[model samples]
Target chain A: MCNTCGCNITPGNREFAYKPVNGKTAVSVLENLLARNDDQAEHNRQHFDKHRLLTVNLMSSPGAGKTALLEATIDALRDKYRIGVIEGDLETENDAVRIRARGVPAYQITTGSACHLDAHMVHDALHKFPLEGLDILFIENVGNLVCPASFDLGQHKNVTLLSVTEGDDKPAKYPVMFRAADIVLLTKSDLLPVLDDFDPERAELSLRNLGSRAPVIRLSARKSLNLGDWLDWLIGELVQKRGKLASDVLVQPVAEPQSISSNTGMQG
Target chain B: MHEFSVCQALIAQVEQIAISHGALKVQSVKLRIGPLSGMELPLLEHAYPFASAGTLAEGSILEIERAPLKVKCEACGLDSKVKPNLLTCRMCGSCKTRVVSGEELMLMSVELITT
Candidate 1:
């Protein structure tokens, strides 16, 4: 505790804990919790624009197969376009390692106890990223369907994974996430044939009820079913976004960086 | 889980304000939260004490102002509060409407005390 004031002055994580409160006077102020995050997000947008980068923020619940989808995506597109990933999780660099194994530049942001990835995390990831001429960047957010919906990570697109095993009513239960999604990917479709409780029609109804017009694409990354649509959507977006630059990155001049370079430890 | 993080940010904001105004403590924080804001008030309140632990804002009250979803009808020009699942204008029964409010997750004001 501070000797001057009865406030905490810890020397560690909460070091900035205590400061002397000003002399006896009442002060009025107004601010928003999201203001700082939004500011950083705007800055990230400018940076992506400068590099002509198309960034995607992927959010989903645990076991939603986000990593798997990303792996398959990288495999299909790595030969065509320069891809990079920023994997977010509460703990573990394993996700980043997985993406890097696919020969794509991957960075990881461990959020500690935080449930979502904010713009500040993405901004920091970009600072040390060694790859250049990246046509597409994907920030795979921490696997939490509820929290990640609230924070914007300054991505060009927000793709949410909804595993079929989780049930069809998720959109109704979590309207905010569904409403914010630019694309709702229904993963684990291979198991849908066995899961009797899940209904794709009901999911569509729920999305409609929530006033979401975003397209829902069902696919099983394991079986590689209907992945063509996902790739096609991505290709169309990249082609539209890069304009002339699309031709350059599409050529795949370099082979896949299979050996995960030491400097790209992805943990910074 | 998200609420804890959010409350931490709120407390930080409050602490910054207290420091800037030379206040001894924070009394209350008034907020406007809409349905679309994606924050659960009860969770936020529950996380407040944890966020304010050992801080000047400890025991501070949170005054929440409800910002219901409101939309202005483009076809009929009538603006009013709306239901969460329904987007049609209540007056003319038209679907041609745009959101005007209820998306706020704003800190309206803060009450602070010195000494």
Candidate 2:
């Protein structure tokens, strides 16, 4: 059947063509749509390495208290770690301003209509940050649960925040997001006790069902409940990053000079 | 939905592949989207034309294959292909199943017309 004009094509009057390729075979491309984005993410990873930065990408739905959690986290850890933030929102410098008020350098990327922030956006945003002195870089992705899971923002860790009011079935309903997280932050735990339907065990089961081994830390950024545990987790990650950096420095000072010269020569 | 952005990415990818292969037009783009891929298939199809506008893949047919949810039962240690809504293990009725293919969004292949 003809695809258009609602008429049968005569011998040579065909508009659509599906030829036999004339002996030149077609190439088979089994590629992912996000391949280019992931490549850029890898480039961003190397950039993070160049600056000895430990990057964490946080994802959640809007009003999941991502910004509030960040504000609290920044206030608690600013004295210990050199924190920097790249805030992604649909539209507003509000989150970035909040972070800066806590004394951390912040750059905001307003995605406009885009539901998520891709690695290319993060790569571009890196130019605004003086990453040399930054120890931990947090890229708070646009308020979205689904879209952000597929796009890696060159972060070393993925923390997905789910507030109790959002319900226990989130991990079951939106498994991809929770499955991608290294740690699931159960925000708004202060309200959980009052809510009759929100069950913590039920939520944990959903996480387990998705094969997520991410430790769930329940805290309320609004009330500062269990914020200590959250702070400890951050401190532990920072210590690991610092330890690795120290080990790298130690090895660099004692490594053979011939390989170093060859590497330097390649750049020259 | 987020399908517009996904289609936008898909268009960018298809255009690059077509240009690199020196192909003049794309005949078909085959995608394997899993049930747990977090993308709506119909919305993606609707967004395709807009995303591919002014590109080589503007009129190309998007062939989407919905990959079934495959899970490995933690208890039974066996793989089971199940429906999207029901993720429990068929053999053991266990909810402790690890998803294997429910999060796929792969461009399996592209048929291009080279001049």
In terms of lDDT, the best-performing candidate is 2
RMSD of each: 9.4, 7.8
Q: Which digits, one per residue and each the tens of the lDDT, describe model 2 over residues A1-268?
A: 5312113434465324224365222445566667778889999987886676779999999999998998988888778778899999989999999999988999999998888999999989988777867878999998888889888778888999999999888988887788789889889999987987988888887887666668898999989999998888877886787677556655785467664443222232
Error (Å) of candidate 2 at residue A221 is: 1.7
Model 1 per-residue lDDT tens digits across residues A1-268:
4222213334562324333355333333345578778778999986785577788889889889999999999888888889999999989899999998989889999988888999888888889885467879998999987889888778888898899999798987787787788888989999987999999888877776554667889998888999999988888877776664444444644464432221122222
Model 1: DockQ score: 0.37
Clashes of each: 0, 0
Which sections of candidate 2 miss by over 4 Å?
A1-25, A242-268, B83-90, B93-97
Pairs of residues at least 3 apart in sequence or in different chains that clash in candidate 2: none
* Model 2, span B1-115: residue lDDT tens: 7788788988888877677556788888999989777788999999999998899998988999888789998888989987654567888878777888867888887788876
List of chain B TM-scores, one per candidate: 0.89, 0.92
lDDT of 1 at A148: 90
